[model samples]
Target: MAEEGVMAHIPINHPARPVYRVLAGLIGLYIVVFGVFGLVETAGDDFFSRGSHWVLGLRTNMAFALVSVIFGLVVLFGAVHRGNLGHLMNLTAGVVFLVVGLAMLTVLQTEANILNFSVSTVIVSMLFGLVLLATGLYDKVGPPEHAETEREMRSSSSARPGR
Candidate 1:
């Protein structure tokens, strides 16, 4: 089935899973630091002001900085937690970053751009989203038996013609 192929493509018990997890955690740490700097730079500013304040080479305001701090903390927690929690968090964060980037791009020159996003910020967000997505896709965990089955399925599928 198409769903089976989709689900089966995700590697289970990957050897590099820990590396990806650490990368995700590092991204979370970077976000937290950026947010902290943003908050400091935007102190006393209006929450949603479209001012030219910048942090870590990205435009930010009080509201965006606050949200970033919270989001980064949650991501950090997910990265530290064992099991599927990190997978889910990475997937969710990837989607959120992409959506926010697109949304901000659409309103870059409009008055509705509450996040104070710039082109560089959008690019960074999209890059982060893609990295997180890749990490999530390759970070699945499973028992030994499940991993063996997955390997077998992949081998069989690859051996088939026109598959």
Candidate 2:
């Protein structure tokens, strides 16, 4: 019952699912490109240096660039895959991006900022997080019959008085 309740809340076979998936993929591609540029720009710099290197309008260092490339690849994998794997990856990536953005924002003025994230980077991360979260919420996949059943259940549940 609990699982059914949870499933009922998520949209299956949504019309905009493909768009969301493509958007996620695009975000991933952007991140990958940024990371690559960052790596090139930060070459010969210290791994965690608070240098003046910027990539795609965001500050970066060798360490952060490497992390970005790896993380972006993971996101790309999630976007490319089908079914619950993509859903789970997107949800996890969204939470990670949001957390990283907040954490970077807090340390923007301190030496603890290992990634050398600028304000713009933080903003972009938060925006990407929101988009990924929204995509995940409505990215469920299921057969037409299941979608129909889910729709009926949702309608019936909404029609009933407070139960």
Candidate 3:
């Protein structure tokens, strides 16, 4: 049998507002990075210097990046207003971005023989996803002072009861 690993808390209840604010800012930065990268890719064929176009083309990547930026904006708003649902929406977007990032990596791996992604690019994407996941998990817990936020989220949920 394998040993179990302890689950880590997201520190949502650290009694400090700065952490959340910092997280929002960081997420926003990540969103901008993606958006900029996508736009650049679209604007030029050799954006990555890999000499090969992304599977969906630079335009498609730009769209995905732009969506990610929008999601980040929502997250920032949530952090500022302390809205639980807004944070959840951000988490959802982050999750989507993570999945897409993974898919992008897999695609790159398949096309490695033709073109390769830089080590930094892979590391950055993976790290970004991990960050988003950690933050989302923390938001889900809503520990300590965030109980109200959590409750508001439950009450406002669109899901039917007893599903």
For model 3, what is the C-alpha lDDT against the true structure? 0.53
- TM-score per candidate, in order? 0.92, 0.92, 0.50
Per-residue C-alpha lDDT of model 3 across residues 1-163, encoded as one tens digit per residue: 2224532323344344456446756766656666666656656444233443343223234445556567657656654555456456556656765776676667664643222443344555566666655555555435454655644555677476774
* Candidate 2 wrongly placed segments (more than 4 Å): 1-8, 157-163
Q: Is candidate 1 or candidate 3 better by lDDT?
A: 1
Worst 10 residues of 2 by lDDT: 1-10
Error of 2 at 25 (Å): 0.3
Model 3: weakest 10-residue lDDT segment is 1-10
Q: Find the candidate with the highest lDDT and give its number.
A: 2
Instruction: Tell me the spans in candidate 1 whose CA falls farther than 4 Å from its real position.
Output: 1-5, 160-163
Q: How far off is residue 154 in model 2, in Å?
A: 2.4
